[model samples]
Target chain A: MIGRPTAIALIAVGVVLTATAMVLPWYSTAYGGGVEVVVRAWGTEIVNKPGDWPAGELSPWYGVPVAVTAALLVAGIWVARAAVAGAAGQAGAVGVTAALVVSERGHAVEQQGDFAVGFGLVFLVAGTLVALAGAVAVQREAG
Target chain B: MKKVLSVVLLVLAAGAAAGATLLPFSELLISLAPGQPQTAYVTTGWSTRFGGTKDEHGPLFGIPIVVAAAAVLVGVRWRKVAFAGAAALAGVAGMLFVHLLNVISFHEAGNIAIDPGLEAGFGNGIWVLIGAVVLAFGAVVVHPDD
Candidate 1:
């Protein structure tokens, strides 16, 4: 059996990773100039304009989502640790499914046209299968 | 205490997952129908960045959220719950990561427009987070052997 603190720690790591990914430095090409790299803040946008990479400022409102997600992750882990394994597993499954669905949509947007069609289908089908498998696995384990 | 907390978590998690899955549809239906002419809500910068007709990313993450919830509910032991929670966190992290990437892509694409519907995106994230927190609380309350 895993310890509560360890479970919480795992969740904390995930939250940090998610936040870092948002603020990490990303590189992209300029329209005419060489490639440019910049640090992406939590609530900002990076744009390549007129052959130059520029940072577009986003409203502080953007941070609301990040904060909310962080809170949820923390709470979910804490609750899962205290609850029975079965319940915890179910909660985790639901959370994971929601996350996967959102991620797939992002993937579709990233790749459009034929790519969207192919990749979207893959995400839908594959993601559903995976979620189902996870749920079933949890059920079996809990039982 | 463990059993009671487990049930509570299960119920809350299920409710949260349902809400996350359905909220988008309600928003779309209320906004997109030509006859209705109601304001549409857009979440994420995907539409702004990619120049798409609609934002289609939220539903994609739904699958994983459901999976993670299920995993947690069915786990029989503490180790299982830990693993499941870890997986759930990973899914949440992945979603956030992709959104960040989208921010970069939008920046690179050179078209950053704030969607009037951006509130919807924030709402979705907030709700999901709430569900996650509730589930976590339940876990804590139901600590096995208590």
Candidate 2:
């Protein structure tokens, strides 16, 4: 079983990972003549030259990860107040993370580039850890 | 509390997985000869091409989900042993569904490699279904035997 503070810490770390995932490299490609394109979880940026003009566009799915992280953050805080409810939150987060990972793979595999592991991967691992902690914490509370 | 939550998750997950078939699983655009590119939607476990993947593969991903849901509900209502079976089945179903998505994403739309500039990507349906299944499985794993 996990202690309240420890579970909180796990949730906090998970939330951070989830938040960072949105900005980190989900996918990247370098075309001919120094043209580079990087796709984040939420946005896509194309850099024409190393120090020239870079234009970015927000993906429609950008809000999905942000919303997920926000929920995890709230769940982390809730763990301090109520372990059972927080466990449910953690479980929900785990589901979302898993979904993102599986779906992202389909998109990731199709792209041609030097692909870096996306933030979605980070969130999946973190969310799983947080969920385990929450599960343990809830058992402790119940017992 | 654990049982209730698990049941809810299971049902919702099953629902989402079933719903995914209705939405486009993947989008395949094939540019066979330049300006005459064709777009196709992989919908409801059936593949379609701009010109013609109308394979009558009956609900590629939905049957297992329905079975899992029935198993879960039955397990909760009467036999506790059913939960484990349902979980195992759901896990397998989830993997198969994800694999199907992968195949759809990379495979040629019309049995030939897609041309350059053609797009192939996952749709919202797969995401929702994956998430829901994970949630269901996670709930089962965390459920306490009271």
In model 2, pairs of residues that clash are B47-B53
Instruction: Estimate, for each residue in A1-115, the C-alpha lDDT of model 2 and write its tens digit.
Output: 5676676666666556656665576555565556666655555566675552332123434435344434635554654323333333333333433444444444444543333
For model 1, what fraction of the real interface contacts is kept? 0.30
Question: Model 1's lDDT to the true fold?
Answer: 0.41
Docking class of 2: incorrect
Give me the runs in candidate 2 sitting further than 4 Å from their true place: A49-58, A63-66, A79-112, A118-120, A139-143, B1-16, B22-39, B43-146
Worst 10 contiguous positions by lDDT, candidate 2 chain B: B79-88
DockQ of 1: 0.18
How many residue pairs clash in each candidate at the backbone level?
A: 60, 1
| lDDT at position A79, candidate 2 | 43
Q: Which lDDT tens digits does candidate 1 get at residues B7-86?
A: 56655664565455444322221233334343543443122212245544444444555555555555334534534453
Candidate 1 stretches with Cα past 4 Å from truth are A1-47, A50-56, A59-143, B25-38, B42-59, B76-121
